[model samples]
Target: MKLGACYVAKDNELKPLREDAYFICNKEQTLDVVDGVGGWAAKGGDVGEYARQLMANVIIAVHEEYMLKRSVDLRRVLHETYFHTKVEGSLTSCILTFKASLLHAVNVRDNGDRPDMAMELVVRVEAGDIVVLGIDGLLDNMYPTKMEEILKRETKGQAGSVCLKKVAQQGMRCTTRLTSLHSLHSLKLQKRQD
Candidate 1:
């Protein structure tokens, strides 16, 4: 049974979609949700387009190859691409696979060793978990932790729409926080250099 969920959307002008998307499907008794990070398809790059094509083929291959085995291997679905002549920038993604309670995930990021900076979150998602997918325009400001708290507090038994409305109320706050974080990071980097 495919009980996994996924979401992807444009977060900024720097590659509106950033090539990240997630999906869940059954592979035998285990289920795997693959998170894909699309490469930069900037002014003269094909990362975005190629990433999508690569992912599509990979997903199909996974289903065909792993369905009978019932176990989802993260390494099997993930492969790294090296560039020789082109300046290739890659985005990061996270995938989670599970069976009843067993969970496994694969995460790839544009920023090395910084999975936390990316927007993908794979927690113990409930049947009631409200999955919100939007561009950085909406989330770049507010951190995921805050969003989770807001949703938990304001939308106990309400619908997803109501929860999202409450989240919207805090959009400005998110923007402020984003700016603050940016400033702080910059300052820290400057201090290191000094």
Candidate 2:
């Protein structure tokens, strides 16, 4: 497996903080992205703090699980990490694990309530397949065809940076839209044959 990642903060004066966080555990072939709920800022919360803490706890939980020789159960990991994260804001989380040519994904959107269950999915992948993960900043701004075109022009190692740059440019051009660019983060993973 080969992975590349990139992050860009929102280029706005009013909201200078970037509220997205990501984690990559190469040893366990796991990746996580958390987006802090910007609405919390209206309630006097530090929008980015909760996401940062949640990602930090996810790293700890993943390492602990690996050290204990436990299987990569994304649901358990999410549940463990969510409860352990005692921060003041809400967030949306996406966790992914790659094993034996299969990708396991768990996604949760916190609606100011305790997250009881997450949406889960498993998909089989093949060598040379590419998996892209990003927060809404990137997804909402760029079209699928545009993203595919950019990725198709880059090598595996360059995909992350190139995609981020292209997406950020697109977001800048669309600044007149209702939703200005939020923090943008992207992870590009390519399956390689051993």
Candidate 3:
């Protein structure tokens, strides 16, 4: 699989910090994203720092699992990472694991208002298939149809950059109320037998 990713940080006066983080492990065929709850900033927390630390812990967890020769279990990895993350803020996390011809997705949200819940999904994938994973900022600004159109026009490697640029342009045209931190990942499935 080939992965492309890009992020745009908000430049506004109110929220200059970007609280989203992403990691791609080519050897493990995994993609992970974490979006820190911006509300934490109101409580004197550094959401960006929490997000970065959470992601760093995730990398460590993945590496430990790889070194142990254990199968990559998306749910287990997320659980372990969350337990190990000693940050002060909450976050929403999504992890994608590619194994054989299947793609496994696990998402968890830990906002203070509601219970911490997780969702899991598995989908069959084929060579040449494109999978897009993004944070809420990008999803709120760009519709799926628009993203499909953009991806169709650009090569796999350039898709993430183009999408981020388009979203940044749109955000610039509109009010600055939109969150400045936008992150996206474009994954192109390469040759693999079923």
Q: Extract clashing residue pairs from model 1.
A: 11-136, 19-38, 28-70, 92-108, 92-109, 93-108, 141-174, 142-174
Prediction 2 TM-score vs. true: 0.82
Deviation of model 1 at 26, angstroms: 5.4
Clash count for candidate 3 is 0
The best candidate by lDDT is 2
List the candidates' TM-scores in order: 0.51, 0.82, 0.79
Superposed model 1: Cα runs more than 4 Å off: 1-18, 26-43, 80-89, 109-139, 153-176, 179-194
Model 2: residue 183 alpha-carbon error in angstroms: 20
The superposed Cα distance between candidate 1 and the true structure at residue 111, in angstroms, equals 6.5
Q: Give the 10-residue window scoring lowest on summed lDDT in candidate 3.
A: 185-194
Candidate with top TM-score is: 2
lDDT of each: 0.41, 0.69, 0.68
What tens digits encode model 1's per-residue C-alpha lDDT throughout 1-194? 23433243445877675444334454443222222233233345555544455445446645755756646554454431111113333433334455464444444444343323323223454454454443333355567677677667665444443555445546754444453322111100000001
lDDT score, candidate 3, position 186: 28
Ranking by TM-score: 2, 3, 1
